[model samples]
Target: MSLLRIVFKSLRQHLLSTCITAFSIALAAGLLMSVWVVREQSRRSFTQMDSGFDAVVGIRSSQLQLVMNAIFHLENSPGNIEVEDYEKIKAEPGVALAVPIALGDNFKGYRIVGTIPEMFTHNEYAPGKKYKTAEGRLFDPELREAVVGSFVAQKLNLKVGDEFEPYHGLDFDEDHAHDETYVIVGVLEPSNTPADRLIWIPVEGLQFMSGHREESHEELSAVLVKFRSPLAGKTLQMKYNQPDGHLTMAWPIGAIVAQLFDKISWFDRILEMLAYLVAVVATGSILASIYNSMNERRREIAIMRALGARRSTIFSSVVLESASIAAIGVVVGFSIYLLITTTAAQFIRAQTGMVIDPMEFHNVMLFGPIGIVLAAALAGVIPAMKAYNTDVAQNLVPVS
Candidate 1:
């Protein structure tokens, strides 16, 4: 019989243990690949995030908080800037566009942002990519009409002409819903940005919503600013980012978002270490499974030796068996990776409107599986050496 046939026979004899060990290896490989892909893609996506504006002007607070609140629709506003402050920022030198946004309410947990019609009509969220509606038209600036983003519409099953009331605050509360009813006039096309998860209304609609305190009506959450030139941004950054200034301006939005990942880098490192530890444990399981089976296989090894199989042949078979199991695990691991990444992508899209492309090829995908196979093969060396040192004469003697 061929050496591969011999290896197959041995594997079949220990099929249950083989399958279990291979499954452990698959889990390890899948987890490692998933972590690396998420880490790299998240860093890339966040560091390059764009939100139609060059800078955000708000009440003096953390720049990261301001960007997250204004651009990403996350967290509470630092505090409101005055209407006069908004107008002043708009009139500043080099300011090409300044749209005031008021944020305070949500519809079924989806944020309801209030901004001018000019935001969708004039600005490009991405270069050459203006916000377009898949259905109906932009909300009228003077009316209580809304333009829902594609993601929010899909999740809420909202359509044009459908009227809904806004709930007070970012968190949903059925009892605290405003008496004001707003009609959905448009549904925005999916832009794969944070805007896709927002519900947009006229700035007055949010600021003057029924039950809102009168003081809140005169306040603005932040002003989204677009500058005509880079020098203009640097000039204004110095103007607003002063200790005596009441308003904070966050320029270069991407770097502000990138700081978030930098602050939480330690948590990322923890996850990476856990993944490596799991992989090590899984590799050790492969060694233990094969090593513990060696005692039972010694008589078989002796017989194969008696049948003229070379010692080197027995050794190579053990190593090949280990490699073959790992190879099978690598194949199965891809399925696990697909399942995890697909679920993660959906959750991320729902929460942040960012698409994570699992199909995108990364170097880790190429090397991760190969490294596991090699490690498994190396783990087989001790057992292969045992097979190599088998004494045929002693084991071949008949037992009483």
Candidate 2:
């Protein structure tokens, strides 16, 4: 029989061990691939998150928390600031434009932002890029209309002309559903930012929904501020962030997010180490599976030697057998990796409303699987050497 046929026969004889070892390697590969993809996608998401606004103005609160909640529309707003106070900042020396932000409601966990049509026009997602709709136009500030983000529209399955009532605050309070429903007049184009997860209406809509009495202080959760220059922004941030200032200024959300990531980088490092440790255990499993089978395979090796097989042939066949298992392990590992990542992408979109493209190819995955293959080849070394040293005369004698 050819070397390939012999290898297949030996593997078939220990099918359970072969499957177990390959499965262990596959599980390790899947986990490692998942961590790599998440890391890359998260880095991309953070790097591109800035919408070119220079600063955020909100009621005196944690600057980091304010920016995260306001600009990202992430969570837990830092209360509200008087619109009159915001206007005061808008009229400040270097202020270019101030877009009002009011958030007091949600629909199924997606934040409902109350801002003007100008937000899409004046705001820059990048240096020269502005927000635009994928299909319908921007909602008119004069109408009782809503504009949902691309991810929001898809998750809620909303379309232009659809109408829905928002619940009070971040919670889904049936008792606090707004008296009036808002029609979906438009859907913003996907810019791959947290903005893609919001539902927007005119600032007046939120004020009206809250039933504030006439002449009451019109309050906003925050304001998006752009400056004429970076120096102007720094000066304004210093002025507003002063202890005497009722409102705080948070500049350049990109920087705040960077600090946040830096603080948590150690946790990410821990996860990475754990993933590699699992891979090491997978390699050990390969070693044990092949090594344990050596005794059972020795008699077979002796018979082949009697059939004129050289020690080199026995060694090569044994190595090829183990290497084949390792190769199969790599294929199975990648298959599992693909399956898990695709499912995770869908789950993340459904739960967190974050769009992650698992289909996007990441470079690390290229060299990673090859490393697993090489580790498997190395795992077979000891057993292959033992097979090479088998005694032909001693093992050819039948046991009593």
Candidate 3:
């Protein structure tokens, strides 16, 4: 039989051993792939959703919370500020535009925003594009008309001309539903941001529904401001830090990204450490298996040598067997990785409303398999050398 055929036969006979090695390698590859997928998707999603506003101006709160509430619309605002204060900031020298946000109430945990059409117009998300309505039209000047985001529309099965009563508080059933119903005049095209998860109405409408009239000091959740120049962020922050200032100004993009990674640093580190540990264990297992199997194959190696198989051929065959097993492990591991990531996508979206694309391939994923293959080859070196040095003469001698 050819050396390749002999190798195949041997592997088949040692099926358990081969399978164990492959499984070990697969686990390592799968974990690494999963990590790459999550990291890449998060970076892409955050970048895409956080383009327009340079800073978020809000009542004194955690910097991260301010970004979460203002840019992501994920958390509640710390407190409310007067609309007049927002107008003053809008007129500041380096300010390009200031968009006011009024938030209170929810439809099944998703925030409802009250703002002007400028909130959509001035947004920088999905650059070079504006918030387009997928159906119907934007909110009209008339009170009680609103626009629903695509996610909201799909989840609630709402369309243009449909009317729904807004609740007064966060809970779906606890708070009293607004006595007044709001007509869904429009449904916004999906921007894949918090915008897609919110119901938007005219600021005046929200104020009226909440009982805040123009004559009184009406409070706003936050203000999103774009800068005329990049340097304006630092200058504005300094100016807003005066003791008399009741609000805080922050660079949304920088602050949000930094604080996000910072909070998750421990989790990231744990994953990375586990990945390394898995890799080491996989290599050790493969190496130990090959080293142990060398003793049982010694007589077989001697028989092959006697049959005219060269030392180089014996060595190459052993190395090839290791390489084949490693390759299979990598393929199996990637399959498992794909399965896990795809399965969790929906659950992740439901819980966090963050979309995760599993099939997206990155260059980093290639390294896991390559490393496994190299480790497997190295693992076979000792066994391959022992096979090369097998004593054919001694093996051929009969016992006295």
Model 2 scores a TM of: 0.90
Give Cα distance to truth, residue 181, candidate 3, Å.
2.1
Model 2 misplaced stretches (Cα beyond 4 Å): 1-6, 212-217, 398-400
Work out the TM-score per prediction. Answer: 0.96, 0.90, 0.88
Name the top lDDT candidate.
1
Residue pairs with clashing backbones, model 1: none
Write candidate 2's Cα lDDT for 88-200 as tens digits: 88898898888888887888778888898878887787777887888777888878889898898997899998999888877666777777788998888877667788899
Per-residue lDDT value at 79 in model 3: 84
Model 3, position 132, has a per-residue lDDT of 80
lDDT of 1 by residue, 65-94 (tens): 999899988778899989999889889879
Q: Per-residue lDDT for 20 in model 3?
A: 96
Clashes of 3: 0
Count backbone clashes in candidate 2. 0
Model 2 error, position 103 (Å): 0.4
Whole-model lDDT values for every prediction: 0.89, 0.81, 0.78
lDDT of 1: 0.89
Model 3 CA deviation exceeding 4 Å by range = 1-6, 171-176, 210-217, 343-355, 393-398
Model 1 ranges off by over 4 Å: 398-400
lDDT of 3 at 21: 85
- In angstroms, give how far residue 236 of model 1 lies from its true place: 1.3
